[model samples]
Target: MKKSLLTLGAILSLAVISCKKSESGNKSVIKTDSTATIVTDTDGKIDSVSQSSSTVDVNGKKYEKTDFVYKATDGTLVKVVFKNDPKESTVAITSNKKTFTLPKAETKGDETIYKKDDMTARVKGDSLHLEQGDNIIELKRTKI
Candidate 1:
């Protein structure tokens, strides 16, 4: 009877140990939409651009972010980074040897508009439109 009780106790102990919870209990998930384009202004308020699969670590916790890039009429590449936080969003445009940092833009209906000096950038859907004085440039998304 004693041997049988000891065996039962050991089995119960093993079962409890096997069912222990995992450590940390923290999980992270990242999702990206390649079809979405982000646009912002060029006013020196924003500095850096974030990558599409960029990971930010805060106190050992990971967060996900995204960015967008456009081609200017001068053939220079323009990169726009996005930040997800309570503070204002920033935008930085890099073309050749010139870089313009801008603030988060205001939304009007389905369009986002950013303006600085005499230039205005409008992002609508997957297209970006830039208007300066009498000239207007339109940029569309291209898959690579």
Candidate 2:
């Protein structure tokens, strides 16, 4: 009887620990159809030419996040990067009908900030190109 009770206690403890680990291991949610909007922050105004829409789709079965692409009014292709884990993150921009990938790190939170250098693509004289896969988006920049 004592052995059985001890075994039961051990099992319960293991279950509790497993649950806690699962909760902590994956703190991020599966983001789908995430919209990229441009807005002015409290500090000052931005010079973005026009607002464009960007979408993110987490491919089913593969369970991987893909790149999101946005075309600004000035022909600058924008990409979003993961905020939490930027080191292994990527930014893909489709410019001139060609895809350009950018090297970046992943970050977290809704209000995240990103830069152009983080991409695998190039930002030359008057063009910004990004590259990414079907669903992987490059850099997601927030002004908050």
Candidate 3:
């Protein structure tokens, strides 16, 4: 009786292992849509541009984040890094060699606005409209 049970267990184990191998054979490697491009701002702050959107280490914990690269009207690149916390969201806008971290001010329907001091950013779909002092910057998201 014991010999029969041992044989049955070995067969079951082999069947499970073979099933796993078959299931894994058709799996493909998925790539991240986001890419990282480290840039230094005027304030000397380094933004690593998070490696991936779904996997970003924030304060030692994983959080959902996305980094966007936009093409300005003059062809300059505007990097916007978004990090979300449990309570609020933050947007770090680096443009024209300057950078500012703006907190969530309010959400107006489809547009979410961020503000800090004299800087303001309004995000609507693929457009990023930013205002600083007397200068207004308009950008559309582009592929990096």
* Top lDDT prediction, candidate number: 3
Model 1: runs farther than 4 Å from truth? 1-51, 55-65, 72-76
Which TM-score value belongs to model 3? 0.57
Residue lDDT tens for model 3, 1-144 = 999999999999999888743555545867558665565545678744333354567688666666778888999987888888676799888877888899989999989999998989999867889898899989888754
Stretch of 10 with least lDDT, candidate 2: 135-144
- Candidate topping TM-score: 3
Residue range 7-124, candidate 1, lDDT tens digits: 9999999999899786846466455565733434356453343335465788766554556777666665666554544455555555566766555569899887777778777877
- Candidate 2 displacement at residue 122 in angstroms: 14
TM-score of each: 0.48, 0.25, 0.57
Model 2 spans > 4 angstroms off: 1-63, 67-69, 75-87, 106-144
Better model by lDDT: candidate 1 vs candidate 3: 3
Point out the worst 10-residue segment of candidate 1 by lDDT: 44-53
